[model samples]
Target: MEEKIHITDFLVIKNAELEIKQINVLIGPQANGKSVIAKLLYFFQGISTEFLKGIRSQLSKRELDKAIIDKFESYFPKYAWDGTGFSIVYTINDIQIEIHGQAKNKTKTKLSLKYSEELKKLYTAKKRIFLEKINDNQLEEEPLRGRGASEASIYRQHILVPLRTSKYSDFFSDPIFIPASRSFFANLQKNIFTFLSSNVDIDPFLTDFGSFYERAKALFKEDIFIRNSNDKQLIKNLYKAAEKVINGEYEYKDKQDWIISTKGKRTNLANASSGQQESLPMLIVLCVLPILKNPNLPKAQALTFIEEPEAHLFPSAQSLIVSIITELSSTFDLKFFITSHSPYILSALNNCILGSEVLGKNEKSTERFQQINNGSGAPLDFEKVSAYTIMDGKTINIIDSEYKMIGAEMLDEVSDHFQDVMNNLLNME
Candidate 1:
């Protein structure tokens, strides 16, 4: 089963085709459609959730179609719809879905959808059984508005359980988008859910991110009381790696997030540094991944979209953050899709790829790789890594096929340009 996407005439993106991979990185300047592409991927990958929503609500074919369209429009607001027209084609495991958007009138826009027969057949069969169960009063008619455990459990039992045994199970994982404005939610952690519920003007992506952020934090509210020592040690190692990135140990107290420094001073998020505020939410997720993967807790596989993970950090810290990601990815069933403006993060990822290449050639270099950066290094599968840079309504692959890593020249171009400016100024005398 192959996974790929084609997007054309969408926002700043004129045309782009990307092969989805385990480690996908999109690097570009601001407003060059990096986030736009990320959101589109999120929306399409999340079609499984929409399908479940359709069955749970007993939506008709037309109603389901409208629901999906509404979701797409919500992600791309009316202001973003100013584009003349757009089309997106997403294929995974041979199930293809196409969406075309056009301006129907000045006041309205219509999104036309075409789904593969496999998807339609699966949805129809599931919906039929769901309707039969409802008619027989064999399943609870749980309200989905709460989005609480009961609703999740009901859906999992009715839909996910069956899908898990089928060939389409790979499509069931949820796509979680962690937006660049994650710090805003981190600062409002105490009241984010209430604020989001009361306010409708906030971006839908932020709302979803806030929810996941909250869950990640809650994972650390209590102690990790696992019986497995290896699992426990892995969590400790991950948290230690994360601490180097944020420059402090994270603590949750009195229903708030706090950071304890090396000197034992405690600073709550409100009084903490901007770096902490910006990095805390992402760091918390890094800390919680292993905990969620524990056999005791309910485990879930997810396609995680991380936007500007290097936001408000030094270059060394940025490298450490990438290390944390690689370590977790190596250990867990998570795939990371990263969007970054920082070449430091990309360079750090390249280091991981290079380490993998070295190890691939000579297994004896394993010890040498571990010696780099105090054992923070983790080897990546270069085959599963893909990098692209977006500009001028297009994306260019930056991954070097021969080297099996992002090319050094691509990472150095921006730095080299600024250095040339410095050199000219120095010679002005």
Candidate 2:
């Protein structure tokens, strides 16, 4: 069974359904909060207590607590939080979870969780405590300063996993939260491989290649020697799916720095072209490892979120990336959610749909294309892919490639529309 995520009332993804092997592309104008949506989801899994405390400074304790409670209630049956005075209701694998949160005005917020029968009892007790503390007179006591609000506690309890080109250690751990920054790519060349090959007693040069070397050796029927060949075959393959080849080599002497030889043999990752050069390594990290980590993991069940994958590459590279993502989805139990402003990426995705259709034309062709029961199988339809444009005023309108309107706004839209509803509820004495 695939793990599905239904996001409601969080960032720009008001109401979005993300399933495995599915590619969800968020396209539209800039500053439309695509990054915000991505950040929220990345941090949704295991929110840290420290981060939650930081967000508490924005709203009153009563209002923040209610918002947190509502969020938990929506995801019920799958996951739960207890103690902490915050509650979460979401289902994963048929199991129900109820999250609890604890906040004492400006004091530190504590979090706890419950499941099944225990979740209900915990929630009831929390609800009573929360209501009892909602006295209007407490408003003058100066809402929780700093990271001690109920909302902060709730956010800290749910984690967000980010893959960016910047340093965000407060949120991610090594091999878990991958930053898309230049240093991150450089580190992949230096650290990732060595960490994987720690158990093997191979030569130092081979050891420097890390897990990538092992994976390459297993995939291709040949040895990838760093110094002996002097040819660019291995480097060529690395840049095979990429547009421009900046420079990639296994460096010796400097165990810490993995040199990226860009234009004019300048051996610094900082010197490489901005977009594609920066994007290539991130793509390798985001795409390849997830597949290698769990071979049996279903493509239709995994959710991979990428932000601005079209960062640095030519049109061709962008197109290739779209194809790679599509192929990955088709092969593994994976679902891809990416935010892009590049028309080339969108066009490439459209081409995948067309290509699939062409292959589904005949019985033998269809069988080859779908790999299922000849022409009787369903053709590859891109319509199953959903795209949304987040508009101003918190309104998210679903649109097609040509900006054609697709009916059915998500619950996020409803919440945005009823902003006054929340304001009124919070203001009620």
Candidate 3:
């Protein structure tokens, strides 16, 4: 089954349906619901993580439902209502999950979530059998006496272990959402978690992203971040490309992030340029991906949602960042949902898709193409990519079928309008 998400009457988004792909990109003007779609996908794809935890803690169905509702509310504040309600249907593999809500008292939203019946049955059956064994004293009794860490461990062994390897596993891999406000966390450094704890009203998504960023940064405390031998060279190239994007190599020294420039000048993160601050957290995560491990879903493909990767970046730098991300995706077998408002980002991705086509035809042109792509191996299969423009409460495909590239018309719209204004001024003169 095709993976996709359909949203209707959701906040600023009147109606939008996106066909999810390996390299999904949404590009349009600001506040056109790009981030809304990204967050919805993040919330749904991450359901597996929460569901497993609910089962591990032996939560009743009613408790689990309330927990999920609360979690959803945390990601999306109650103020996003549009005087009505919304519906979201996210389909992945064999699962068709629906989230429908109704507005109440002009301030509250009542939500009802429906997922695959198989999952519900599985959860119930597992819980029942585990409880039966416990009642019969067929399992270890000491762990049950405390009902603490040991009991949780037993529950994991009985339920979570099988759930991880079951057919539902693919439906439940982690989705990392890197918000546009990521630089805020970078500026705070180690104090980010502390800040989040003190400020309880911050966006839950941003808070979670801050926590993930902290963990990613922690991976670099050791001498090496890449533990896989086969991927060492590829991961190293990723770091080199990332350095070019931020215009400096990142160093974790004295418990602070430092940027060491090519000219031998050193500046800590707080003192670095805004561009560096905006781009460093993302670059760090990309560079450290090789070492990041998930024991539960060890073989699942990683899904990442990045908002405005071009923030505070030069046009050329934006292109380089796109190349680095595309190359990293290809190298790590990861999938990305990226939101951007930059034409340069689209142009860069077009180059990647075209590079893949050109190199596939002529192996002899490898070195030349490498030079053009800045040695980032910036080649992406066009078939694996999907580009969309969200505007006027609608989603439109911006890829040109014949050219096998993102349509130049879409990327040149703003430039063309400005060019017309220039022509008019010249005529007046």
Ten contiguous residues minimizing lDDT sum, candidate 2: 158-167
lDDT of 1 by residue, 201-249 (tens): 9788888987887788777634644343356766777778778877788
lDDT of each: 0.78, 0.44, 0.78
lDDT of 3 by residue, 154-245 (tens): 66676666655666656756778888876675568668678758855777777778788878877753455465445777777777878888
Model 2, range 1-429, lDDT digits (tens) per residue? 333344444433445444422567676667776655544344343332222332333334444445544443443311322212333344434434444345544344454454455423433444444434443325546656432464334333322222111133212221222223433444454556676677744332123223443343233212333223333342233334432323344222343333344443435443445763466444454334332433222221334666666766677666556655665555443456777776666666665565565765643453364333211112235655766656651434354445222222442454576897888888995
TM-score of 3: 0.89
Q: Each model's TM-score?
A: 0.89, 0.48, 0.89
Model 1 poorest ten-residue lDDT run: 293-302
